[model samples]
Target: MSSTETATLSVPGANLSYTVRGSGPVLLLIHGGNGDANVYAGIAEHLAERYTVVTYDRRGYSRSKLDNAAKEYSLETHSEDIHRLLTELTCEPAYVFGSSAGAIIGLELACHYPGQIHTLIAHEPPLTHLLSGDEQVHARHIQENLEITAQREGIVPAIRQFATLLGLDQSNGSSGRPNVEQLERLLANMNYFVMREAPAIRRHTLDLETLKTVWNGASMRIVIGGGRASYGTFPYQCAVALARQLGLEIVEFPGNHLGYVHQSQEFAMRLHIALQD
Candidate 1:
């Protein structure tokens, strides 16, 4: 097994905590809401065999500290953070895998810095903006109701609903045993994710024209990934819409929305194949 090394990068408004394992070309893993660098621990070991797998805590998540306690989160800000991380770590274009809100951030990063990314496998980005008419309205309505749940009912009930929204099966949950410490941290992040991160994701709009131009050329290969078990879910539907808009096929992975956690080994294998192709 490759020895994991921990590090930090100083970025605008925050000091990002990151990890690197194995060697070769860089492969950065960006986590979704309430997830930190450690979220990718299971799959990073497998991927590390072929690539220098990098994972980081997005600002205000865990070890990553925000300069301002109340710093506003946005896709553009998160994207810029990733750009800086890649720029600091590698001179060559790097491979990026971002799931959920992280995927949305990846799209924003690719849009702004096409030269910094080799290939981006965006898994289940909740691009409500891409949905048409009623679909868009419905998705936003669900999100709004979720906020109300979080505010009135509390984070626990809201999280359960959030899980349902992502098409996750509570019974199956994670493939590996849950870590008590990690679960506590996730619980702690719940309020922030609901009050801040979720809203930021909703407000984000991708530059479709720029993305189309980049996908048309060879500067960067953008692949949309959706979990087989997450079919018909809002995020999966959003992924399908994205692939259609880009004229690319949506690659199916194992498990549901939290596939990387529940189906780490299989998800890693699928991701490796996608990156290779």
Candidate 2:
């Protein structure tokens, strides 16, 4: 393993925090929601031996800060912030691995600015276009529940719902043991994303038009939801759809939506192999 250091960086609109570790090719590690840069800690360390892994807290999470002058943050701004980070750090176009919402941002960045990214491994983006009418309505309804829970029941329940929605509530999974206490702890800590960033999150919309416009010529691959993940889940469905539209093939990685957490070593090895030339 390589030495690790927690580093802070700033872009024009937001103050960002991340960890720079390892020592080879440049790789940007984007966290989904909840937690801080630590979400990618072990994964980054695993890759650090041969990659300069940059894992950071997006504007509103952990040590990163949102600027007072900014009129709320948008996904475009987040991607731009990352672009700025890459420019500050390396000349080589970096490989990117993003999960869940982070995956969504990675796709946007790759699409909007093709030359900056070498290859993007997007785990899942929760897009509805990959599904049909009934399933689409189901996903929208879930997003609606998140809105309602955050608004009506307070951030705690909303956080719980978010975790449960991602299949994190039951570590062994819905089929095995469920840790109620650990679930609540994560829910409390992750409330900031659900409350402060949820609104901005919904604005992300993907369709055939957006795909053609945004990701047309990008080097992108979607990692579909893996085994043990619910077969009828949104993330899996979304990956399937995005892969089809990109006219690229789908690759399977370890674990479910939270694979990076549930199976860190396996996920890391799979990640290295997936992005390996």
**Number of the predicted model whose lDDT against the real structure is largest:** 1
* Candidate 1 residue pairs that clash: none
Give per-model TM-scores.
0.93, 0.85
Distance (Å) between predicted and true CA of 15, model 1?
0.8
In the range 20-127, model 2's lDDT, one tens digit per residue, is 888888889887775656667767767887788888888777567667633665777778878888888888778888877787788777766666787788886776
Worst 10 residues of 1 by lDDT: 166-175
Compared with the true structure, all predictions reach lDDT values of 0.87, 0.71
* Model 2: pairs clashing at backbone N, Cα or C within 3 Å: 22-48
